[model samples]
Target chain A: MNKPTVLIIDDEPQIRKLLEINLSSKGYAVRHAESGKEGLLLASSHFPDAILLDLGLPDMSGHEVLRQLREWYSRAIVILSVQNGEADIVNALENGANDYLTKPFRVGELLARLRSAIRHSDASTVVQTVETGQLEIDLMARVVRRAGEIQKLTSTEYNLLALLARNEGRVLTHQFLLKEVWGISFQSETQYLRVFIAQIRKKIEDDPNRPVHIITESGVGYRFQ
Target chain B: MAAVKLHPFWQFLIGTASIALLAMVCYALGDSMDQWAVALILLAAVSVLAVLFDIIPVLAAALLSALLLNIFFIDPIPDYKIRDTESALLFFIYLFIALVNAVLTNRLRKQEKKIRDREEKEKTIKLYNTLLNSLSHELKTPIATIIGSIDTLKEIDPEIGSQQRMELLAEMEIAGNRLNKQVENLMNMSRLETGTLKLKRDWCDVNELIFLVIQKLPATDTIRIRFEPDESLPLVKLDGGLIETAVYALVHNATRYTPKQTPIEIVTTYNKENNLLIDVLDSGLGIPETEISHVFEKFYRLPNSGTGGSGLGLSIAKGFVEAHGGTVCVANQAQGGALFRIVLPVEISRLHV
Candidate 1:
C-alpha cells in the first residue's frame, strides 16, 4: 500500500518540525513548505493526500492559498492559525478549508482532528449502522439504538449524531461541528453545541453523567470516543 | 470700564507729565531751599510716580533727579555757571546718590518677581501630578474586574454546559469585588487630590491595624500574616483608618500573587536613625524586574502579568503613606517574591494637619 502523504505549510520553523516529527511517527509521509508561494507550487506539483496550512503567512495569506487549491484539486485542506477569533475561524472554514486548529493546540488534540480530516478524505461512506458494543448509530435508516433498544432523536440531533458517529474516534472541535452540521456562522455558538451534545448523550450513553461517547476538552473543544 | 491701550503712547505721556511736574517743583523751590532739601523732594516725588503711575522708567527718574539738582538746586540758581567751587562739588554728590538708589530698588524688584513666578510653577505642577495619578488609578479596578470575569468564564466553560453553571456564579462574584475596588479607588483618589485627606490621627496599637488588614483579604485562612512590632517603640500617632487601607492593599496584593501555599511575612521594626519601617514580603511571581521601578506608578501593570488585578494597589498605598509623611519603595527579592518597604517618621511633627 502507498504511504498516506501529508503536506504542511507553516511559516514557523519549530511548528513545522514538531508536526513533521509527530505525523511521521504515526506512519504518515510528511512534506513541508515555509511560505504560501512555495505551498502553492508544492501542492500543485506533488498532489499530496492532504495539506495543513497556516492562515497567517509572511508572503501571502492561507485563505488565498486555500481558494487557489480548491480551484483544481479535490484534496483535504486543514487551516492551522494563531488567529483564534470567532469571525476568523468561521471565515476560514467557509472559504473551503475542511478543518481548523487554533495555535498553542495540544499535540494530542491536533493529531485527533487530523485523523478525522484524513478519514473524511479517504472513504466517503454514507450508509448503515456504526455499532460498537452497546451503542448503535444507524445512518441509512435514520435511527439510533443503545443496548438493543430504539432511541428517539430530533432532526437536528439525528443529524449531529450521524456526523459524529460517521467519524467516530476522531476529535471534532466546536467550530468544526458547528460549521459542518449547522453552517459556518454557527461556529461561535458554543452554547448550542454544548446543549445538544448533552441531549444526545442523555439518550444514547448508558450514564449521561459519565459519558462514554462524547467528551469535553476544557478551554478547547469536544471529541467522540 | 475703561478701554485698555494696545500702544505704549499712554504710558509715554504719563512718564512725560510726571517728569515735567518734578521739574516745575525743583525750579519753583530751588532758590529758597537748600540744594539737599530740593533734591530730596524731587527723589521722593519720582519714587511715588514710579509706584503709582507704573509707567515712569527708573532711568528717567535718575536722569530727572540729576538735572534738577545740577541746574536748580546748585548755587548757580537760574544761571548755568556755579556760584563757587563748593557748589559744583555738592551738585555731583546729590546726583550720584539719587542714581544709585533707583537702580538698586529696580534690581531688587526683578529678583522678587522671578522667585514668585517659580513658586507658582511648582504649585501647578504638583496639582497636575496628583490629578493624573489619581484618575488612572481610579479607572483600573473596574476594568480589570470586567475583563477578568469574562476570561474566567471563557476558561471554565467554553461550551457553557449545564454541569458548569455553578462556576459561572462564582465568576460573577469575583467580578463584582473588582468593580467595588475600582469605585473605592476613584473616591479615595478624588478626596486625596482635593487636599481633603484629613487624618483622624490618634495613638493606636500597631498590631490591631495589621489584624484589620488581614481581615480584608479573600480566603483569609490561606495566608499566614506575621506582624512583629518592636517592644521598645512608643505608641504611634497615625490615621488608623487610612493606614489600615494602605496595609490592606499591600497584604491583598501579596496574598493574590503568592502561591496559595506560601507564607506571607509582615514585619515592623524601629530604628533610632530612620524612625519606623514596615515590610510586607510575599513569595509570588515578584513584581517583574522591569515593573519594580514603576510599581508605584498609577495604572501601570507589569508586562506579561495576569490581567485580574486593578494595577492601582501600590499607587494608592504610596499615596496614603506620603500623605502621612512616609516613604514607600518596592523591589523583587533574590530568593523569590516581592518586598514592599514603607518608612514612617517616628517624630509625629513631620505630618501636616
Candidate 2:
C-alpha cells in the first residue's frame, strides 16, 4: 500500500522538521507549506490524505486558510495550533476540521488522532463487521448480535451503535456522534443520544448498568470496545 | 488637624438652625401640649441632632434646648430661679443626658470608621503576602530545575547514553513549560486586576471547548476526565479565549488537588433561560466548608493543602467568566469532592442552529 500523505502547514521550521522526522520514520509521506498562501497553493495542486494546519500562519490568518480549504477539500483536515484555547479549537472543528491537537503534543497521541481521522474519512471502504468480546455488529446486514443471539434494536439505536462500533477503541466525541446519527441540526441535543445509548446498552450488554461493550467517557463522548 | 477642625461660623449656623427648628415646632404645639410633653420633644430633637451632626454642633443644639427648657417649661415661666426640687432635678438631668448622648454618638462613629479602615488595610496586606509567598516558590522551583539540569548536561562526561541525555532534555522542557504557565497566569491576573482585558466575542461550542481543554492538558494515565456534552446546548456568544482559560484553570486546579485515579467529570447543559452551565467535578477530597468561600479570592490557597499553585487560577477563572456577565462558583459535592460550576448568560441572538 502506498503510504498515506500528510500536508504540514506551519511557519515554525523546527516544528515542521520535527513532525517530518517523526512522521516519515513511521512510514508516512510528509509535505510542508510554510505559510497560508503557500499551503493553499500546494493543497490545490496535490491533495494529501490529511492536512495539518497551524492557526497562526505568517501570510494570512490560519482560520481564513481553513475556511478556504474547506470550501472544496472534503477529506480529513486536522488542526495543529499553538492557540490551545477552547474557542480556537471549537471554531476549527465547527468549520469542518476532523481533529485538533495543541502544540508540544506527544508524538504518539498525534499519530493516534491522525490515524483516527484518516480512518473516519475512509470508513466507507473499511471492514463491514465489528466484533468486541460478546457483541457483534454486521453493518452490511444492519443487525446486532450478543452471545450468538440476534438482539432487536430500533433504527436510531442501530445508527448510534453502528457509529460507535465503527470507531472501535477510539473516543467518538458527542458532537461528532450527534452530527452523524441525528444530523447537524440535532448536534447539541445530547439527551437524545444518551437515551438511545442507554437503550442500546440495555439490549447488548449482560448488565447495562455495568456496561462492557459501550463505555461512557464522561464529559467527552462515548467509546466502544 | 486643620481639616478635622470645623469652622466655628458654620458650626454655629448648623447648631442655631437645628435649635430654632425645634423651638418653632414646640411653640406651635404648645397650645395643645403640656409642659412635660414640650420638654420631652426638645430632648428628642437634641438626641436626633446629636446623631446627625458633628460633636460641636450637637453640643450647641443640646445647650440651646436645655436653656429653652429651663426658661419656658419650668414651673415659673421665663424665670431663671427654680421653686420646686423635682423641677430643678428634671432640668439638670435633661442637660446631662443631652451632653452624654452627643459625646457617645461621636465616639461610636469614630470607632466604627477606625475598624473599617483597619480591616481594609489588613485585607490588602494579606493579598500581597499570599502573592509574594506563592511567587517565590512557583518561580524559583522551575528556574532551579532548569539550571540544575542544564548544568549537569553540560559538565557530564561524553560517554553518557543518549537516552539519559534525552531524559534530561525532557526534564528541562517540563520545567520550562511549568515556568511559562506560571508567568502566563501572573500576566492574566495582572490583566484582570488592571481591567485591561478585552473580550473578543465569538460563538462557542461547549463540547469542543471541553475536548480542547482535555487535549491541551498533559496526557495523564492516572486521572481520567469524562465530558458529557448536552445535545441541545446552543452555541454561546462569549469571549472564547477568556472562558477557555477560565475553564482550563478550574480543571488544572482539580487535577492538582484530586488524588490519582480519581475521575474528573465535565458536564455542559443549556436551559430555556438562555444560560449555559458547565460543571467540573472531581471525586476527591472535598473542599472544607470554611475555605469554600475564599477559593476564588486572589492569592488564596486552602490552608496546609501543600498543592503547588500561585493561587491565581480560580481567581482568574472567576474574573474571566464574570467579564462575560457570567458567574463561577464552587461547592463541595455530597459524595465527597469539589464541584465548580460556571453559568454564563448568553444572548439569544448569538445562538445559531
Candidate 3:
C-alpha cells in the first residue's frame, strides 16, 4: 500500500523545511511549495490527500488556492495561518478548508491534526457512515436514516448536518459552522443559520422545543452532542 | 488743561487746537506775567494722558502744544504764526522732538509683541522635541531586537536538535511578536493622541480574554501564572482587543522584569467596589519610589538600569487601559518585588454569551 501524501505551502523556507522533515519522518510523502502559485500546481498535479496552506503567500493568497481546490477536489484542505481571528478562520473554512491551524503550533499538535485529516479523507464509503443513537448518516451517499426510515434533506441541510455531526462534541462557533456549510459570506446572515437550524431540528429532533442533538451556544453559535 | 484722555486722531486735533489757543493767549498777554502758565499747563496735561492711556503718541501732542505755544503765545501773535527767523527755528526744533517721541513709543510696542510671539513658539517647539525623542528611543530597541534575531536564525544550520531549533524559532517568534506589538503600541498611541481609537463595545467573556492573554505569553509556561477569577464574574461589554493587548503588555513587562528562576503570579479579582483588578506581581528588583511617576512617561527609564526595553511598555499599557475606561498603576511590593495593578470597571452585562 502506498503511504498517504501531504502538501505544505508556506512562504517561509524554514517553516516548509520543518514541516517537510517532520511529516516525512512520520512515513507520509511530503511535498513543499514556497508560493501559492506553485502550491496550487503541485496540489493539482500530485492530488495529495491533504494540503497545509498558509494564508499569507508571495504570489497569490491562500484563499484563492482554497477556492480553486474546492472547484475540482474534495480532499481535506487545512489552513495553516498566522491569522487566528474568528472571522478569518470562518472565512477560510467557508472557502472549503476542512480545518484551520494557527502558527507557532507544536509539531505534535500539527502531526495529530494531519493524521486526523488524512484518516478522515481516506475512509471507505461504508465506514464513512456515522451512527449516533437512532440517527444514521451515509456521508458519501448523501443520505440519512432515522428510526429505520429514510429522511429527506436538501443539499445545504445535509452539509450542515454532516458538519455538526463530524464535530459532535465540540462547540462549533457561528463562524465555524457558517464557513463550513455556506462559505465566508454567509457568516453575516446568522439569522439564516438560526432558521436552518430550526428546520433541521424540526426534521431530526422528536420535539423541536427540546433539542437533544444540536445545541445553541447563544452569542457564539451552535454545538452538537 | 482738561484731562487729556483721547484717541490718537482726537489727541492730534486737540493738541493742535490747544497749542493755537496757548499761542494766542501768550501773544495777548505778551507784556503780562502769565504767558508761561498756559504753556506749562498744556505740557503737563498731555504728558499725563500719554502715560495713563498707553497712548504715548500723546507725547507728540504735548510737543506740538509746546511748539505752538512758543510760536504764537510768545512774540508771534495777530498773525498767530511764525514771523521772525528765531521763532521759525524754534517751531522746527519742537516738531522734531514730537516725531522722535512717536517713533520711540511705536518701537517699544513692536518689541513687546515680538517677545510674546517668540515665547509661545519656543514653548510649542520644546514639547514637539520631547515627544520625538521619546518616540524614537522607544521604537529603536524592538526593531533592533527583531533584526538581530532574524540575522541569528539565518546563520544557524537546518540540522540542529529539535529542542535547540525550537528555542531559536521561539526566540525569533518572540522577537517578531514583540516588533508587531511595539508597532501596534505606536499606532495606538498615535491614534489615542489624535483621538481616533473609538471604543467598539461588544459582549465578551472576561475569562476568554484572560486565556487569550495567557496564550500570547509563552514564557508563562516556565513561570507559575495563577489566574483566579470570581465565580460570578459576569459577561462584560468592553473593547476586547484593546484590553487583551493591554493585559499582554502588562504580562510581558512582568515576565521581562522578573528573575529567570523566580515564579511570577498573575491574579484576577473583582469586588463590589465596581472595579475588576488584575495584579501581576513579580519577585524581581523593585523600582524606587522616586522613579514611579516617570515609569508611565514614554521612554523615561530608571537611572543606571541596564534592563533593555523600548520603555513604551508601561506608557502604552497605561494608554490602552485608560482608553478602555480603566486605570493602571505600579508600586513596589512589600516583599521585595514590583506589583503592577490594572483596574477596569466592571461593565454592565449587556448580552449573554
Candidate 4:
C-alpha cells in the first residue's frame, strides 16, 4: 500500500517544522504550504489525503482559504489554529473542515485525528463486514446480528450502527454521524442520534447502562469498539 | 469650549440696523401709541435677538435698543433728556430687563453645554474603569501561574520525574492559554465598543460549528457536555468566528460555575421561523432571580460568587450575538441549571442539501 500523503499549511516555521518532523517520523509522506495561496495551489496539485490548515495566514485569512478549498476539495481538511475561540473553531468546521486542533495540542491526539480523517477519506476502507464483541454488521447485506441471532433494527438505526461499527475505535462527532446517516440537513439533530445510540446500545451491548461497545466521549462524540 | 465664531462687524451692523428700524417704527407710531408700549416692544426685540445671537451681538443689540428708546420714545423726541419721573422709571426698568434677560440666557446656555460635556466624560470614565478592573485580575492570574510554573521547572530539583515535568508544562500551557483568552476577550470587547467588528458572513453548518466548539475546549473529565443538534436545521449565514466565541463563552461560563463532573448540554434547533436557536444548559447553581437581567452587563459578576473570570465573557457573548443580529438571553432552568439561549435568523437560501 502507498503511504498516505499529508499537507501542512501554516505560516509559522516552527509549527510547520514540528508537524513535518512528527508526521514524517510516522512514515507518512508530508508536503508544506507557507501561506493560504500556496496551500490552495498545493492542495489542488497534490490532492493530499488530508490537509492540516492554520487559521491565521500571511496572504489571506485561513477561513477564506478553507472556503475556497471546500468549493472544490472533497477530502478532509483539519484546521490547526492558535485561536481556541469556540466561534473560530465552529466557523472552520461549519465551513467544511473535517476536524480542529487548537495550538499546543498533544502530538498523540493530533496523530489520532489525522489517522481518522485519512481513514474516512479512503474509499477502499468502506469495509463490507465489521465484527466487534458479540455484534456483527454486514454493510453489503445491510444486516446486523448479535450472538448468532438477527437483531431487529430500523433502517435509520441500522445505518447509524453500521457507520459507527465500520469506523471502529475512532470517535465520530455527532455532526459527522448525523450528516452521514441522516444527510446534511439533519446534522444538528443530536437528539435523534442520542435516541438511536441508546437503542443501538440496548441491542448490541450486554448491559445498556454500562455500554462496552459504544463509548461516549463527553462534550465531543461517540466512539465504537 | 471653542469660541462662537460670529463676525463682529456683521453682528454689530445687524444689531444697529435692527435698533434703527425699531426706532423708525416707534417714531411713526408715536402719535397713536404711548411711550411705555414702544419701550416694551423694543425690550422684547432685544430678548428675541439674545436667543438667536452670540453674547457680544446680543449685548450690542440690548445697548442700542436702550439708547434708541431713550432718544426716540422717552418724553423728549430725538434727545437724551428725561423730564417725567414715571417715564424715567419706565426707561430704567426696560434697560434693566433687557440686560438681565441677555445675561441670564447666555448663562443658561453655558450651563447646558457644561452638563453635556460632563456626561460624555463620565461615560468614558465608566468604560475605562470596567476595563481596568477586569484586566487587573484577568491578565494577572494567568501570568502569575505561568511565571510560578516556569520558575518551578527551572529552579526546582533536576531529580523531578518526567511526569512532574509534564505536569509543569501542562500548567504553563493552561496558564498561557488562559492569558491568551483574556487578551482575545479584551480585543473582542474593544472591537464591540468601537463598532469595528465587521461580520464576515458565510454559509455555516450549525452542527459542525457546535462540534468544533466542543472539540476546541479542553475536555475536562469532570464536566460532561452533550451537544444535541437539530437534524433539519439549515445552514446559517453568520460570522462564524464571532458566534463560536459567544457559544464558547457560555460553555466556559457553565463549566466554571458548575461543580466538577456536572452535565452541561448544548441544544440546537431550527425554529418555525427559520431562525437558528442554540441553547447551552448547565446543571449548576442557577443564576439568582434578581441578577439575571444584569448577567450580560460588562464586568458584572454575581455578588459573592467567588469565581475566577474577567466577567467579560457573558457580555462579550452578548456583543457578538447582537453583532450578528441575534439575541442571547439567560434564564434559570426549572430543572436546576442556567440556560443561555441564542437565536439567530437564517436566510432561506442559505439552507441547502
Instruction: Compute DockQ for each candidate against the true complex.
Output: 0.01, 0.03, 0.05, 0.05
lDDT of 2 by residue, A1-225 (tens): 899999999999999999999999988999999999999998988889889999888899888999999999988888886533545766777777877777767788788878877888775767699987888899999999999999999898898999888877566677788999889998876656656776787799996645787876434457787
Question: Candidate 1, B66: how far from true, in Å?
Answer: 44
Ranking by lDDT: 4, 2, 1, 3
Instruction: Report the error of model 2 at residue B285, Å.
Output: 12
For residues B5-119, could you state the per-residue lDDT of candidate 1 as single tens digits? 4345554566556766767875776457777677677777665544433233545656766675676667656656777877877777666765666566556666766888899
> Model 4: residues >4 Å from true position, as ranges?
A1-5, A29-31, A37-49, A60-76, A81-106, A130-137, A144-225, B1-114, B129-133, B147-157, B180-184, B187-191, B194-296, B301-307, B317-353
Judge the docking of candidate 4 as incorrect, acceptable, medium or high. incorrect
Q: Tell me each candidate's TM-score.
A: 0.39, 0.56, 0.53, 0.54
DockQ of predicted candidate 2: 0.03
Clashing pairs in 1: none
Question: Which stretches of candidate 1 lie above 4 Å from their native place?
Answer: A123-127, A131-134, A147-150, A169-195, A205-212, A215-223, B1-353
lDDT of 4 by residue, B1-353 (tens): 33346687777787778878987987897678688888788888887776666788888888888888888788777799889889889888888998999898878778877999999999879978987877887788878888888888888748788899998888888888788778778888888999987886755656656765776677682238886556566666676767888988998888888888888999998888878889999989899999899999998888977847888999999999988788999998998999999998866433242
Question: What's the true lDDT of residue B267 in model 4?
Answer: 94
Question: In model 4, how large is the Cα lDDT of residue B193?
Answer: 92
Find the candidate with the highest TM-score and give its number: 2
lDDT of candidate 4? 0.81
Interface RMSD of each: 26.3, 9.9, 9.7, 10.2
Local error of candidate 1 at residue B317 (angstroms): 23
Q: Cα miss at B326, model 4 (Å)? A: 9.2
